[model samples]
Target: MENATTLQLDPEANSNQTIDSQEKILTGDRATGSLHLGHFVGSLQQRVQLQYRYAQTILVADMQGLTDNGHNPQKISANILNVVADYLAVGIDPLKTTICLQSAIPALAELTMYYANLVSIARLERNPTVKNEIKSKSFGRSIPAGFLTYPISQAADITAFKATLVPVGEDQLPMLEQTNEIVRRLNHIAQQDILVECKPLLSKVSRLPSVDGKSKMSKSMGNTIMLSASEKEISKAIKAMYTDSSHLRVSDKGQVEGNVVFTYLDAFHQDQDYVANLKEQYTAGGLGDGSIKKILDECLQELLKPIRQSREKFIADPSQLIAILKEGTERSNDESNDVLAQVKKAFGLNLF
Candidate 1:
């Protein structure tokens, strides 16, 4: 079996791997914040494995952040490379994965403009994904045009590369449906197949809870373990972690349910017996939160030590990291342009 590092994406090549229905998978996250342990468990873990199994395109969604956070270009800019750092640290082998910046490509925006007219304005309002995001961001009354049309842009992102699989959590199934809607409409209107239908691959774990036991871990909540955090920083974050609410003392039996510590163990630690033993001790009493935290510290350190080291190395020579990003964006543009050309031809908007 060949390593993912040996695979390559050459846009100019004639004899490359087949671009079959199973060739590509596209997915990614926003770079508006630091990545956390939840990111590792829920998404990055799958990305590392899929690199070998499929042609993956990981888009750093910097442009999407601007829809609501338009005033904070600096915020998105600051975290762009940091997110790339996280991706590289998590072992997203650059050779197999096209780690692209969404904002760097104009072709995608063009595709979005073309598809936007194909769908009704009323249909855009009914898109479940866009509606949820609008509500979540409290944009009910004053939604940005870009915010309302994000699904169109997403369709552009996926169809521009002819992505076949988009790994999204269950909550994001609507976005996949919207993208397929555009694909169906575009093909039907053109009387030719200009795009491919994409299937959803929800995360195995779906989402991870925050250290504060929040249903979702987010950097905004400050209950996250930053991937680049040092050992002392990781320790500090773990010490501040929320524990069982009922167990006020070491002598009291602790409830494992809704306990962030145990949940962390479940998500990060695969040693079921060890976790079970710890849970039993915790449930019966005499197992202090400190003890459990110490166990978590050790486990997380083992997981993060290598990644932290890699991050430090990448951070030391950011120019080289930027070079990789530039190369990736350039390669992605070539592919995007090729697909865009086909789409324009389908619409009879191009000649010669």
Candidate 2:
């Protein structure tokens, strides 16, 4: 809720540099797996629009993916390109948005080390996001230190890019809050605003539920519809989506609230008036689950057709993906290293 304007940059220290007046955006996803429809409605769609309006940078956070998957590094390594492909498939232009790899940017790791000192273990343990993840992952007694401290790493990611806006869900507000805390602390220590505070740009659309309708859409849960799902796969997932169990007959009045079929229709079906009519008919006891499922199947197939095609093209040429990532990372490295220099200068680490 606090404004980023309160944090001031020391003019004398940054006098030679022409400050970028454009609002810089930093957002990303871990490379644990391919992105899903939940991503499409939630953040990916927003990122596509943001690229055209602002200075946007998408970080493929391969390093952060290792936090909980330290035992299975291959999963993270394998999906890095797949994730980038999904971005391109969804309309994120590499020419407009700089897409970089996290591990490729050494300054992020270095910044994480410096930012970690500003936060305490007790403070990290208290973060709501960290606590919930620990419980969900069932890390009970043997939590990975990296898993516990990745929030600090995230703070490093945001600050290193001097990001002014970060797209996040409501649940992720805490992470942005923590990022600002570190930025404020580092500036206090330096007696100058070497780091810029960032604010959360909350998504307007609600998160899409998994097909089961009982859980959040997640690849790890195998309950999500992937952006790159084949036609048959999408159809199969829609067929299995949870609907009002009590609506046993086409004439039986259905409950639209918890029906996953209706949920997907609301998100994917472009014609709201048509979807609304369907919902009304279904709720009034004249509609069947199969009818809505059929409609949803059509909608999803149409939505994903082009995305899947684009993703396949990018996936086929791994070198092109690599080249785009390399160029973005190189550009990002220059920007982040400059910020890192200022941070180190504040810490009096620039002995040379």
Evaluated with lDDT, which candidate comes out highest? 2
Candidate 2 minimal-lDDT segment of 10 residues: 6-15
- Cα lDDT of all candidates, in order? 0.83, 0.90
Clashing pairs in 1: none
Model 2 steric clash pairs? none
- Residues 200-313, candidate 2, lDDT per residue (tens digit)? 876668789899988878887879999999999999999899999899999999999989998888888889999999999998999989999999999999999999999999
Q: List runs of model 1 lying over 4 Å from the truth.
A: 1-21
* Candidate 2 global TM-score: 0.94
Residue 177, model 1: Cα distance from true site in angstroms: 0.3
What TM-score goes with each of the models?
Answer: 0.91, 0.94
Q: To one decimal, what is the Cα RMSD in angstroms of model 2 from the true structure? A: 6.0
